[model samples]
Target: MERPTRAWVLHPDIRGDDRRRAPEPALEEATALAAALPGLAILGSEVVRLPRPHPGLLFGTGKIEELGAVFAAEEVELVLIDGPVTPVQQRNLEREWKLKILDRTGLILEIFSDRARTREGVLQVEMAALSYQRTRLVRAWTHLERQRGGLGFVGGPGETQIEADRRAIDEQLVRLRRQLAKVEKTRALHRAARAKVPFPIVALVGYTNAGKSTLFNRLTGAEVMAKDMLFATLDPTMRRVDLPTSDEVILSDTVGFVSDLPTELVAAFRATLEEVTAADLILHVRDVSHPETEGQAAEVRTILASLGVGPETPQIEVWNKIDRLDAEARAIWQARAARAEPHVAMLSAVSGDGLDAFLTQLSQALRGPESDETIHLAYPEGRALAWLHNEGVVRAERTGETGWDVDVRWTARQKARFDAL
Candidate 1:
């Protein structure tokens, strides 16, 4: 039950000389996005590069006509524009190309629509899509009943007609928002439970397809969606990553950030983003082999800043995908990371190279002051045992003559509890 596939690329050469000059990165990003839909049978894809940007249509008349010809020749069923398209422009493009039109926002929405796993994720996607559709009501709409009542009169023939499409979209928006609020409450409850566990959260965030899920799976030994495709992981997946010292910490893999993410999508996904904002540490994973890694990193930073996870946050730069790079490139990256101490580490999540070093660093950062005391308490005093379970890692436990014999490493606050007993 897979949908029919049709794809096209429109890297609108926007007016800014510096901005338009970065075509290679856009192509690379698009390639990653295309790879995400491996199951879809893409007939063909053509990159439509405009000579210059046009605010209304994004591309010039000549370029649009030229694309129209190519679409006809290829029998393309969809046009994927890299830039945002206005309602008028989208309608015109659909009519001329005789296909469904999708800009970057729509494309991202489509991906989210397919990848959303949890109930909250699905609700978020639906809300975003509905909001987007509300704006496009002018382009394709239905006939509506007209009302022609006088200013003081209650009844008469209808003169003005309400836009059917707009009314429908508004109604849908209200319903979607109500559903999302319910889902938010459920997520809040789950988050509260995690907070009580006393485990610090570490969230993995980066540009799309940066191997966040792969690294997450390796660290936590849990299978998440990891692939060589943009947005391979959508819903935020959390698991307990066991540290070398036998300490368990909550690790989360979140939706990857992309350049120019639609505002609607961001607003909808705010609940999932709570993981990032609440994180005690942030791992910004980057694909070191990508030539445009710097630009990608900038994009991720921009999105994070918008989410309020600013520069002050405790961030660890994870230079991932090292296995794809040559020895010289690897050396260069290693040097770069060294110069950026307290913020960087180079590793290949796929091959498991340099993971131990990364993990050692991660554990040390998460660890607090060492403990000296060992205490034993009775089974009936289970509240104390539960408190110890959360405050520190339990090293050993056994039943003794009087009570439970326990050996553990705890913080000063937790060690003080023993004196209270």
Candidate 2:
């Protein structure tokens, strides 16, 4: 039998400043989840930019009743709100609308929970989930918590289930921390290995669905998943990219940032975000076609600052998705590119347009000068020679009978190490 599409998305805006106007962007995120998951169909979505809230419902009682009628007529099985709702509000809303309800936090958590493929990722998601669930324990299970325990309240210590839940959550948190620590240790070792062959790490970061993963794959020829959805790529992915100047570097694709990211998620995903903290360069990919492009860029910068990425960190703003822009806007951005600050690259990652200019600029930034140096090495200095081979742009290598003659053009760090040797 065929079932009706029965999911409705809601975005609530608590009116304040211009920033609190419309939450269509958040509703769009919820719509992406509906697209990914099965059995739930999104019937429609609405934004309620209200001046005040109601106690029983987030909206006024009259509006709530109005939405209730709409839900009934539309046969909505689920109501996905694009904002965090309290446990009591969720309970009341579900009863009033006669449907399941999920908030922005819950939705984001579910996305993370689904996208977590690795053990560490799964553990982190579970830990975050448990932390969130501990507060909303009422939603999952409706039970009396005031039963007398023999040990503490009414039942014996062994029979106290609430204590067991608390204990279990603590134990899980400990285990997750230990596992994440191990993962961090392993990542540190890997980072050290990369340092030995030091390639500048460039990370692409932007708002969700900002085409970061697409740009990443376009640059590195990698097949990492790229979709037009919120939080498409959860884990960090790194790949080697050979620039236009024949300089090879490591380009990392990081998880996209969003406005009003759940605080729990920010802490939970710190492990994955360490890659961004270690980046030598950041490509702030902006969806220039998005109506909220400037606002999205502000959010990305805000998150970057909160992550302690200092002002001195070199960044190249890549205004992506120019293909989606109209001709006038594209031309205007192009004209303004000449005066664009320190580093701004306007290009369409999908079309491979203007990529050469961006790559040329990046290569020049990576390799400051092309002053070739004729370097001499003592006999049997294979280790130093190998280091040069890996880290430097070796123009020519000649193995003489007495020693080795190498003409290398590399970065300052590589030259310093070679000079030390």
Candidate 3:
């Protein structure tokens, strides 16, 4: 087997910046990102304090030289920066250190490229990658000085290598957009079919590695790729799940959200995330044990709001991974959750603790407001009676001389389905 490439992660702690996060947790998250990619063995990680960023080098010259020595001593093959790195800064850093360098966006693109399974997901990643690469064309093409003499048919002379590469990338993006359109149409058709099935869709969303897939597997009893790694599941998966109240729902597991998610990726994956927009209920699964859980939840909410998921959409906060917390912390959180808002549920998806309560809550959320209705059906309409019985919606039934009078408590969707039957 090929040995894993040696890598180092660095998180720049920008002093005096109001938006700067705590350096330690930021560095830890960056290291986790690097570890998520295959074929990369992290050698070390650190938080570099920067009073101010240098425009060209991103770091002080002394710091660069110092880190260069460390990189050399450690035999690091790749260096990942936890924040944005301009193309010029990346080029200069790579040249000075003589090693491969990837900024946060690039590292995330690599992870998405590796994890995407479905055709639409792969295409979206390719488009985003191309878009990202288009900006770095200057650093990529060493032959930018070379000019091509174009014929009259090409309509331009003195087109540099960079321009040619940009044009090629643009063309590739167009092609990808067309292919994505086709896939989106097919997905829309599938969604339309599901709409006819009379089952509400419940989407699970959270920050990366927040145990959404684990919760999904626990609820649906289907094996999905659940792991401790970031971006463990990129493609959306759906399964029919019967909730504790005997109401069936379509449960959807989506790609996890992250802070500072690349704009190119967000636009590219809009179709995949549209499932969330159409959902009847959303479960915001969170790793309650993480120190930055609140910050992570804020990021997820920001992304959702940007996707047009607003106050009108029903949502439940699923406080997951409580098993990882200490006994005192867990009890404290549980108490807080109990006294908190109505839609919050504290549970560990791994050990099945509090799953029953969660499912019951989920059933209630998806069921919406229920009302009792009395209907009289003739003796020949056995199918309608069987449908109501199978749905567990019948409150009471009385037989008469020619027909039956039934009292049922159901949501509008259930009533509609029964009427159609």
Candidate 4:
């Protein structure tokens, strides 16, 4: 493989900024973001304290010159800023440091562009990139059409004016949305088909790198791309899983949330996250071992709220990665889980230690007063057979010259619908 581009991360901690987070953790997250994009080697990262931003340069002259020297000596080819960078600031910094600069939004858009797999995902990323591109003060995000990969932020060409770019971007966005709509319509048909099924949907959501995919894989036996990187799973993956209660459910692992997620992405990926909204139960998987776990959880809740996931939706907070904690720390987190409001389950998805309890709790949470029921129908009663199949309650079906013998298990509610049929 070609040598990875050397990159540095800088978190500008503006004084008295209510939105600011713990500088250290923010820097760490930023470093992870940079490393997430393939072919980028993180040389180093730092927290740059600023009483006030320089508006035009984003940093003082002395600090710029100082960092520039370090960049030159270290041979860093790229700099990833942990927050927004205006077009002017980006241009000035790139010239001052003589290295390509990528703001947090730019970096994330690049990763989404790189990681999106499905046709809809690719279109969503393209639309988001274009939306982000249309706002540039200097250079826009690399032309996504280049398909040159990774948003080409490191060395993108074709910098243009907004008025001209706006027209082009608007047109491209219209085309992309049209394509996305067709893809979404297909997805909607699939979802409609699934709606006819009796299986409840359980969605896993949390901060990126919080081990959701790990938990999802352990429960569903699907090899989704689980990694120690940010935004590891961009598109939602779903699998049919039978819980401990023998209750089959549609388990969905969705792209994880992040602090200060690019607004463009939040809006663009809304449809991708629709699974969470329509779920019967949501598993809010959390990395309980991180020093800033609470903050991360808060961010997840904020984003969920934005998506209109109201209190009416039942949710269980899955405190994950307890395996990373010490005995004492583990006890404290376990205690917290025991008493947490709503529902909380403690487990290490990596280790099988607490999985059984989690599964048992999951089953109980979805439990209902339902029992086995068998229905016999003739081949002429195809409508009833289709209903049973559509309801996903068919356990076994035997076809005879006269009719079909069908075994089904359903709740009173579902059975009522079958009775009506």
How many clashes does each candidate structure show, in the order listed? 5, 8, 0, 1
**CA RMSD per model (angstroms):** 7.2, 5.6, 4.5, 6.0
Q: Please give, for residues 144-254, the per-residue lDDT of candidate 4 as tens digits.
A: 211121255222345444345568779998999999999999999999999888778999999999999999898878999999999999999999998766668999999
Clashing pairs in 3: none
Global CA lDDT of candidate 4, please? 0.86
- Candidate 1 local lDDT, 314-421, one digit each (tens): 789899999999989888888888998757988999999999889888876666466755677887978878777865657888888788878888665345444554
Q: Which is better, 2 or 3, measured by lDDT?
A: 3
Report the lDDT tens digits of candidate 2 across residue range 375-404: 888788889888887665688988888899
Model 3, 194-253: lDDT tens digits are 988988999999999999999999888899999999999899999999876778889999
- Displacement of the residue 353 alpha carbon in candidate 4, Å: 1.5
Candidate with more favorable, higher lDDT: 1 or 3:
3
Error of 2 at 291 (Å): 0.5
Q: lDDT of each prediction vs. the true structure?
A: 0.75, 0.77, 0.88, 0.86
Stretches > 4 Å off in candidate 3: 138-159, 396-402
Number of the top TM-score candidate: 3
Instruction: For model 4, name the residue pairs that clash.
Output: 378-403
Better of 1 and 4 by TM-score: 4
Which window of 10 residues has the lowest lDDT sum in candidate 4?
Answer: 141-150
lDDT of 3 at 184: 94
Angstrom error at residue 193, model 2: 1.9
Winner of 1 and 2 under lDDT: 2
Q: Could you tell me how far off, in angstroms, the CA of residue 296 lies in candidate 1 after the best superposition?
A: 1.2
Off by over 4 Å in 4: 137-161, 368-421
